[model samples]
Target: MSERDADSDDPGDDAEELAWETTGTEIDYTCPGFDVRRDDVVLPNGTETGFHYVEEPQAVVILPLTPDGEVVLIEEWRQAVGRVNRGLPAGSAEPDDDDLDAVARRELAEETGYEAGSLRQLFTIEPANGLLNSVHHFYLARDCEPTAEQDLDFNESIRVSLAEYDDLLSDVLDGEIRDGRTVTGITRYELADRWQ
Candidate 1:
């Protein structure tokens, strides 16, 4: 096993102590969707900046690795992200969903027309700091049971695809999989190596 920094967020912080300090305390701003905050800080180079931040919700993603080592990934045309990329079956944790597992199963079926026999928590990712605070959760769902129903987004021109277990790693390493949540899910699946 490779030893990594305990705090992945502050990896660069160890290289040099922040030769700066926050002159102004963090102040919250009333906002919709996600709240924003500002902090006046002096940089290590002695420059001041207003560190504006935002709050985001926790997201859920599913890695449906079939018994044959084929992984279930979704290809959706995301307007916000501005690209049609491949990713694991994923969705947000909406309030009153009541059943996270059910939500996961529903998303899997809706996005890819596949249902899961079982689910397992794998890992999470924090993609940004400036204006996003989202926990991208990963899970493994195997032995999926496909359904006849397809309820994808209206503008979602999604095409489900599969990648072999071995090729999966290479694709991720070569930056072929650019979606952050999906990348985290793949790495999580590799970490335990449960399917192989």
Candidate 2:
């Protein structure tokens, strides 16, 4: 069923039936960018258990398009993966950032030195809900142009490049682009017309 229909008064919908009740929550660990949260919950069957997840601030990912229709991409060193990963410009929202569009613009400028002439939100998604409490706000940035030098964070190592949209899509499909946000952003942009 469609998500909207399922959210309505659907006779067979069992959302509440399988829901778990959270009795309490605690922070198991704290870090600069994320925290480990543990929730004490009662399952549908009345079994008590603890669920752990990584809680983080919302993030923004930009699919930047130059006036020539090329996509701005970033190649960055990923310590977790032990290799450089290619992806769209993305960053977590800072505590002082109140506007998502501003965050998107900031990240794009910081990572790639590109500024968007026009920016529009495409969609939001939980890239990994089962293990992480995170929301990714996806944006489509058009007419992007390099206007400044990259102002990367202390720990960041990024290189910016432009690629044809078709080539980026091909990389995603051929399993060369494994970054989830980049893949999702590219696919969403491709399917945006049908969704609208």
Candidate 3:
């Protein structure tokens, strides 16, 4: 038997006992930014099934703060949502992107034309682990300032803006800002006691 199977037989190993064994995997569809993958697996109860999820590269989300303690935000058209969405600067890592900090800086510049004097990771999370096999690295960027023109992707339509940090927090608490990544990054930063 495999090591996993052997471990599952241990009486106290609840995690191993509940784990599903992947029998096979297949790509169901492919798109520009992501792919749908289906995995055939055997459940702990001996039932077989297939699970589908989005397969994509890691991403970075930035909460950029200017020297005056304002938060830099972006308003962009999100086709899937069919409306303009306001959020923090974020993007998927490109193939050539080796460092996550560099990716965060690049995305912040590309989306808002801002450069950060210092960048520190806030947290990492899988926003939708059940539906998407994607990870988002959250960052807190300090002393950001406008330094260059936006280098947005061909499909992007974005507008840059700044809001007072307290006001931004209020908006988030008031349900005015609905973007998931933005909400997650903002709340995480706020609760960490490091945003001030």
Candidate 4:
């Protein structure tokens, strides 16, 4: 069943039979995002390996825009990419926060010293498909203004840039903006005519 459809089913006597308990042991394998353990368990008549996975917090990324077709972005050094990556402002989510849009606004100001006058939710993604449980929420900001203080992490070295709307697609395709989220946000916005 699809993730969205799983919760849509009506509860009945069949609900009790939805999940079956495995009667085998579990063994763990990795400790990347968090500690994980897997073990073999008895399932029906055969043995099944059950995995215990750990979780982390969710994250948010904001793509701020102007009514005049301008995209405000950041260019920062990334160790993995071995160079600078230009993209939207993004960061981890906070538990106390009710939604990702709030976090997106916070991160936008902190990273770029720019505050979105208005915020619109875009999309959410599971950045890693492996063991870790993390999400990246995307947002669209309008009429943003620079804040007095920039909330940058101690580990981050970021610069700021603004690209015109009509030219954004070409910029992303030309490799000027190389970050995945950044590229997606830019291309999607341009394609949707949101920049207009």
TM-score per candidate, chains pooled: 0.68, 0.90, 0.91, 0.70
Q: After aligning candidate 3 to the native by TM-score, how far in Å is the CA of 26 from where it should be?
A: 1.5
Q: Give lDDT for model 4.
A: 0.69
- The model with the greater lDDT, 1 or 3, is 3
RMSD of 4: 5.5
Worst lDDT 10-window in candidate 2: 1-10
Worst 10 residues of 3 by lDDT: 1-10
Residue pairs with backbone atoms closer than 3 Å in model 1 (clashes): none
Model 1's alpha-carbon lDDT is 0.71
Q: Least accurate stretch of 10 residues (summed lDDT) in model 1?
A: 1-10
lDDT of 4 by residue, 1-196 (tens): 0012234345866764554454543335443233354434445445455645445557777877766658788889999879988777788765588866778878888898888889888766665545544566778898877763787888899998887765767878898767877777767666774745
Q: Per-residue lDDT of 78-130 in model 2, one digit per residue for the tens?
A: 99999999999999998788999999999999999999999999898878878
How many Å off is the CA of 85 in candidate 1?
A: 0.6
lDDT of 2: 0.88
RMSD for each of the candidates: 6.3, 4.3, 4.6, 5.5
Error of 4 at 169 (Å): 1.8
